[model samples]
Target: MRTFEVPTRDQVSPEAQAIFDNLKKQVGMVPNLYATIGQSANALSSFLAFQGAQAKGTFNAKEREAVYLAVSQINGCDYCQAAHTALGKMNGFTEEETISLRKGESDNARLDAIVKLAQDITENRGRASEETVEAFFAQGFDNAALIDLIALVADKTLANYVHNLTQIAIDFPVAQPIEEPALV
Candidate 1:
């Protein structure tokens, strides 16, 4: 269970309420994870803002799911892994692909690099090594994508932290859970 009550739209600050309203319009409902974060308007708004900023990454939808799947798995955020697993499917990731990502493997070479980069960020706490970043670009990403990786990492870190703190219920179904942890 969550450590404290998750405020509804009316309970949060006006900014968070507006964000929540927009979220509902876009996604049909504000996710419970978002609801919990809404306890802090800054956090909820920051999460939403980072998501929009990260959309420019070199990682495509499939690639984003790959990175999210890998990082969520490593962070032991079952809720996030589950949510992303479902999204991965919606974004065209196969069951085997999702499995490979959680294992830190990737058939799509470009995404392999992104997944690895996300893992490195998770491990290094934004101080990723030069070699790791070099490998990411060498694999085909550009500087802009590299910059977006920070946003992706920030978004995932936020979600994973929420999951770790509260085993948030998934708003969607997911593939089989990744039992092996790949470290946040």
Candidate 2:
């Protein structure tokens, strides 16, 4: 397996260097995934634009983190699972709650809806069941939030796939194993 090189700021184009500078300021350092993305000058900036736009959407931090956790776990991306696990904690999820969310279950009704929807979409390859959609809305998510959810799915899917393909070093606290609940 060929390992993807995580480019340093000097190795990328000037445009990507600027983005790396901004990321360093924003996140304290450019994460390995983002650094790998800087290998494509245009892609890094475009991804930043898309990601920044989504941050302005209706989903709160916790909700957005749930989407990331569910999608990443379903995709089996270790990098993202680790990254979002840390982020999930910062967004107020307990370590146990983070593990539950990663497994597509949540004790909170609203969060369960979000996790199930995200998991269904990822597991089913972008086609969540109608029941999941209805439950998501019944849980008080509007059409805009639905759109945001889809956007988040797209975003996290891209990140998950990137890490899956690159097999990058995990940059955050390691996530625990995802325990599947026993089927009754």
Candidate 3:
């Protein structure tokens, strides 16, 4: 159960109504995350703003979903992990790839590094190591990519933690849990 009242579909603010409507039409449905966020116009607006900001990247939806799945897995957010796993499949990521992301080991060191660094930065409470930064750079990511990843992290963290706190119903089905990796 959510701590706050989730706006009834009819109760959504005009601004959030438009955003959620657009998302529903395009994505087939307003996600439960968005539904819960619809309770707060500012939070839903912030989520959309972050999405807009991250849209300039060279990373395709698959790569982005990989990052989301990896971080969600590490952070143990069932809502995000399940949601992104479905979206990742829509983006053409294989089940194996999704599972790999959940385990933070998709065979590409670059992505693994991104996932690890993102999780580490989040888990360490924002204390990222120099080596982590260098490793990210070595993976062909530039300063802009770093910034974009930070934006993604912030975006997902808000929704993930919200869902965790709320025990938000999974709008998507349960994805099989991937192995919780030994501390990397």
Highest-scoring model, lDDT:
2
Error of 2 at 69 (Å): 0.4
lDDT of 3 by residue, 1-184 (tens): 3265455668888878887888888888888888888877888888787787686775667778887887787677898988998999999888888887777675788788787677766667567788888888999889888878877777778878987788867878788876555143
Off by over 4 Å in 1: 127-131
The TM-score that candidate 2 achieves is 0.95
Model 2 per-residue lDDT tens digits across residues 57-158 = 978889899889998988888899899999999999999999889888889999999889988887888788899999999998899988888899999998
lDDT comparing candidate 3 with the true structure: 0.78
For candidate 1, the lDDT comes to 0.79
**155 Cα displacement, candidate 1 (Å):** 1.6
For candidate 3, the TM-score is: 0.88
Greater-lDDT candidate between 1 and 2: 2
Q: Estimate the TM-score of every prediction.
A: 0.86, 0.95, 0.88
Q: Write the residue-wise lDDT of candidate 1 on 102-123 in tens digits.
A: 8778877777778888888888
- Compute the lDDT of residue 1 as modeled in candidate 1: 34
Each model's lDDT comes to 0.79, 0.88, 0.78
Using TM-score as the measure, what is the rank order of every candidate, best first? 2, 3, 1
